[model samples]
Target chain A: MQMSPGSRKTLLRQVPTVVWVLLGMILFFARFAPAFFTLKNAVNLLTQGSILMILCMGVIVVKITGGIELSVGAVMTLAGMVMAWALAYAKLPIPVALLLSLIVGGLCGLLNGFFVTKMDIPSFIATLGTQGIAAGISLGMNNGNVIWGLPASIGYLGNGTFLHLPVPMWLSVLAFLCSFTLLNFTPFGVYVYALGGNEQALVLTGKPAWWYKTLVYVYAGLMAGLAAIVITGRNMCAQPTVGLGMEFEAFSAVVLGGSFAAGRGTAIGTVIGVLFILILRNGLNVMGIPTYIQLAIIGPVLIGAIVLSVLVEGGAQK
Target chain B: MTLKSFLLRFSRLLALVLLSMVVAVLNPNFLKISNLINIVRQASPQIIISAGMTIVLLTGGIDLSIGSVVTLASIIAGYVLTQTKLHWSIAIVSALGSGLLCGLVSGILVAKVKLPSAIATYGMLWVGRGLAFAIMGAFPYFGFPNAFRYIGRGILLGIPVPIWIMVAVALVVYLFLKYTTLGKSIYAVGANPYAAKASGLRVDRILIYTYMLSGLLAALGGIILTARLNAVDQDIGAPFLLPAIASPVMGGTSMTGGRGGIGGTIIGTLIMTVLVNAMNLLRISSLWQQFAIGLVVVLAVWLDMWIKKKTA
Candidate 1:
């Protein structure tokens, strides 16, 4: 099992540059920001980052199929709004309300899939349309106001401790497992990669590529729905705009994870990617940097890291 | 134009007419001349922005940063106009110049660095928005000189200046796409990049120019928006991104590139403007506006696809 020096070098090169950037960031933040490395802060970061982690799990599924899932943020918002409405107005039990949110999210995903596969619209545009629809419905449902009066019991799902870990952390891990298993251990997973890498081959094999493509969007929608439950439970209310711009963050995390092109990404890679973003943002927060300034820095860092990976690792070349 | 091309071009017009009829029936006030002018004026900046989007779309790319570019360019202009002692005209130059620069960077990212359009432009969106936020920093800029305001507010030949600007922009873009070698190359490149490159057309250069044009036009739209509002803030341009994208696609411009034009975009803009106007006049909750627009975008694009299929 001894590897040659050249082969080892190539193996090392296959590692995305984000790993190093992530290490550097950790060291830099730990030295400069005294509060960055605390156990408490780590818990807080995981709690906050769980929603992003969940969303990224969904986004990577679609990205691997060469489709962008822009509607997840809005879909999550709509799902939360529905759940909140069911809780506050309909007086439904917590479980029913939660199930409703997932259904709503899946329905939105179905619409996106229909637009993309059946209507032949580009994924971004189709998803953008769904974003508008979902966002609009969320806003219109509550007249652009926050919905309050959720059952106290629901908050336990979002904020309560589970085996000394935050509930959100557990839920996010569960989501990661779902995405990981679905992407790695199933015939569907292979078809998903083939959909992006070589659709003609998939079609030639008598596989229904369009159906798998549609399922990718649907999977993303389900994740958004799950995120909605956590966010709603945590806040104890649903704000129509709570999920705003979340899709962009999820997309960035997936791309940052080394899914630079279709058919090239891993669940492990996405976890690192999520951690990279979570750490950067959390570190900046610990350092007391203004939100606006942090935004300016993150943009350059994101693009630079991706470019470095592409150039240095020669990863994901067409 | 052949009857087929004529129908292809004016199908959106028919939709616009039918939509106006519905709105006019529901609210007769919507049909008033003043209100109609108001709609177009309000839509002017959108039309300009969508024109830029249409050009980029024609070249088989998307520019998500146009909204951010709008915010940054106008803020730059506002900073120049209010904070500096420079002539008011300098504000215009600064706005357009900054916009062009943002587009150039995006172009290099997409055309040369070979990043995906969605990712490159999405990054630019953040940078532009962040820069705008940094520059403004918890305070908005206002109180531009009257000369600057005139572009948005003043009347020209019984019409608002914004309307005139919109028309002029449409005409110039229409002509450019029709006659200019570079403009034609944009279509060629979008239709098939490999073929375009093999045929000695500089696909990369065309992509850069298309993005640059989109940026410049977005800045121009921002200038008008700033003039009308008489102020500038970081959030001013955020909402325009969706409609800017929806309009050209609704106008029958293919999202996949190489088959739509400014002519279709203008009609699409009118349809959206009228829809919004109808909603406002009908006293529907403004919250539903986003939903309606989103529905229209999906339906419009769906309709476009259906028509394309039928024709093919």
Candidate 2:
């Protein structure tokens, strides 16, 4: 697995500017805030960030197909609601409830795919519609109340640690690996890139571009489903609004991970992007910055990072 | 307009009327004059916001920041009117100014920096919301001066002031889009940006201007909403975002841009407003409203696309 020195140097040169930003941020936070550079904080940050990390993995797949998946957050919430309902009301076993959550998430994704492929709706609007539907169902499931009283075993999925790592972290890493393998090691990955880069060309190649595109959405939904289980297990309850606004954070993460445009992201790059946001958020929190100010800062920082990446990329081309 | 085009155009209005008939039949009170005025008044700010959204959509760009722009603008105005000794006009100017500034930045990101419109504006959404939250903090602003509240609450000649403002906005937007070179340029840019640039149109400027207009209108809508509620909170503008996009698309304004107008947006707004009214009258759970609105948005766009495909 060892890389030759020359190949390693070229690989280093190809890294995005955001990596530098991330490194600089780490140094800045470590120096300015003594509390931020600890092992405990690092674990805490990743644990807190695991759900978003998982969601971004799914979103990146859809992004590769030149589609923005806005429904993931709501889909996650809906899935959690379904899971909670199964556990508390339907008296289902923990495994059955978890499976039901994944099923719900996949169904929502299928709905989004149907809208985009069959109806020719734009991804954002189609997903926005799905967002409403999912959020609505989540709200309506228990008359907008939070579901509680899960069996004790359910907590292990969210709170337990495995091999000296948090359970959610394990799940997130699993998601990351799955996404990476699916995109890089399979023929489907080629079609996904083609779907984003030149959909018509892919269609003309005698491939079923429509089905692949639909599968991309369904894949995203399944990830949301996975994230939902973690989030629900973490809280031991499912509020209808639990996944509110996570989609934007995941989208931002994917974009910041060097996918400036569609058809151009990698799992390693996505990991970097997730770390960048995690550090920004964790650093700001460690500094005792107000939540509102942190929000104000994140937006400009996101835009600035992308702009910097674009400039660097352009400069490299020249 | 030719007979076919005329029928195609009026058919939306016909559908609105038929929907009203159905609602009226269910509730019987839906046909009352007072109830009708209430619906128009309730729909006023939405129509204004959607009118702005129609302009952006006409340019083949979407502004995800308008909802936040609405919140930011109203919070600015509320702060000005509630905390300062400034005239209400000054407050209005500042609100509009804040929106314009936001739109300008979003436009620069999309046009000059070459970012996607959705991403650029979506970033602005958080920036705007964060600023609003930072300014307002935990306290909601309430109890505006009568002079300012008059815009939202006043009834002139037996019609609510918002309805009047809505009409004014729609009329001005309609005339501007139909008659002005810049308006035509917006359409040209949306239809085909490369062609527009080759034809010597200032595509970037038109985009910036369209976004600016949208921001301004969103501010105005926010102002009316604030005045009506006499309160400004952090999430006040969030609910309006989806409907603003939906109304225009539902009104026969194409999502692809360059093919819709303010007239259709008004009808679209009416249809949407009536649907909500029907839901309320029917006692459908308030919890299901978001689902219904979301479904309507999807169905509207699907129908629009279907009709276009068949026509093509």
Candidate 3:
């Protein structure tokens, strides 16, 4: 609460950079390819952005709690694979299958929470360990096989459109609203920020710091679980390799959205982060930029954003 | 002493020894001369890369670009061998030079431009990977020089040259870190950059040198990797990023910086090699191996923290 106005101004200015990058990407696509800016293209953007947005939101929460979880990608893979395994091999009801996947995902997070809290392990290492656990279980259950032949019900969640938006996109919006409400309007959110800003101080307050801290891990797990659902729906199968390295992408988006990894973040910022990254990728695809070049451009864009944040912060403080 | 701290120092080595025993027991041929030599050869590049990475991590900085930088070096060497037919020496130097440039760029960003090493090196990772892809356009270079093959395959005093070279390189690094003021400064910067700066140690220079060293060592890895494969491709260094950090961090280096050394890192690297050998022999399934590494990374880091807490 005692953060300087200068810092606030700096953070605000950094926020617009993401918007501009998104705007620039949209226009870049529109100018280069007419089809890139169409309603269909917008829908495509949303569908892709939904999964990433969810993952980033999860990451944002963890970061705000002053913890970084690198295992969300592996957790997503686990969730999706379990859901597919239930439906395909066990022939379970799709709803039951879906519930199982979410439960497994949350359990993965809870495992992460347990290790980090009870074991006195740092978040990064603890998650990395559990990430392997999730990946192992997901792969072992399927025996290195891709779980295909998804049921129609689950596929609908991935492919169906609701009022011109993909179902997953709708889910993303719902997730955003829910996450935002919890983060911005709840005491838990306050505690998370305070935890990130000053963990020792929070500890001194005799607040249930470990509970709130571990809750963020659970929060991440839940969001990743939701991401798994969307991703599974889209792929129509669970490939064991479904979510490797997606965690880094989420990290980049979170940073781009002006959510400091040192704590102080927002679901709103994470959503913007997801949107911006997808837009840039879509724009590159539409423009026929070689994949390599597109990937190359990402570096400069990311570095530029960071530099801008620092510079804007310096200027505002000055 | 706390139980955690006590274990941090011994668990990794114990794990290494246990893995070796398992591998050797499962396949009596595990520690055979040729296999042992092969393991050392395979590990040489990674050991060199870790040497550089240790310094960066010691300074409380992470470099995500080492893998991409290796790829870049591979392509550069590939381009040289394919395009010019340069003598082995020239080609090797150019490849290392290219990697050094990448390190310098990363260093400048982190040290001079004041960017977080994680974010900055991450930028370099994408850029470097992209550039590698752009250079080769999906084609890999083949028909490495016969001399190049010698660099990787040639034996010296009953051991592979890469192994000997790695030992020599590690000795130099170990000595430098243990005895040199520059090495001390690298640790100092990581331990407390503000304090180091206040003490009038050139923190920026020290960091820049550390990254430069990392780049060079990664290229050394690339050169050997290319020679071993006898081919260079854009994707040559893809699997290195995680393993590189996993071994060092797992060896009890604090991720928060300012602790650890070539000793633990080399042992850690050897341990990884041994574990991989075990899994391959056990046919534990690739899924389990990946999971195991991930799990071990967390365990090692946590073990280190717990031990530090217990002792302190």
TM-score winner: 1
Question: Which consecutive 10 residues in model 1 chain B have the weakest lDDT in total?
Answer: B2-11
What is the TM-score ranking, best to worst? Answer: 1, 2, 3
| Cα lDDT computed for each candidate against the true fold | 0.90, 0.89, 0.82
| Weakest 10 consecutive residues of candidate 1 chain A by summed lDDT | A1-10
Evaluate chain B of model 3: give its TM-score.
0.93
Error of 3 at B160 (Å): 1.2
**DockQ category of candidate 1:** medium
Model 1: lDDT of residue A248:
87
- lDDT by residue (tens digit), candidate 1, A145-222: 999998899999899998999999999999999999998999898988998899899989997888888888888999
lDDT of 2 by residue, B1-312 (tens): 866565566767877898899898889999989989999999999999988899999989899999999999999999999889999999999999999999899888778877778778887888898889888877999999999999999999999999999999988999899999998888898898899999999888889888999999999999999999999998899888888987888788877777889988898899889988999989999889889878977887787677667655
Q: For candidate 2, what is the lDDT?
A: 0.89
Candidate No. with top lDDT = 1
How far off is residue A290 in model 3, in Å? Answer: 2.8
Write model 3 residue lDDT over B216-282, tens digit each, in one string: 9999988888887898877788678777877788776667789888888888888778777778767
Please, what's the RMSD in Å of model 2?
Answer: 2.7
**TM-score, structure 2 vs. true:** 0.95
Span of 10 residues, lowest total lDDT, candidate 3 chain A: A309-318
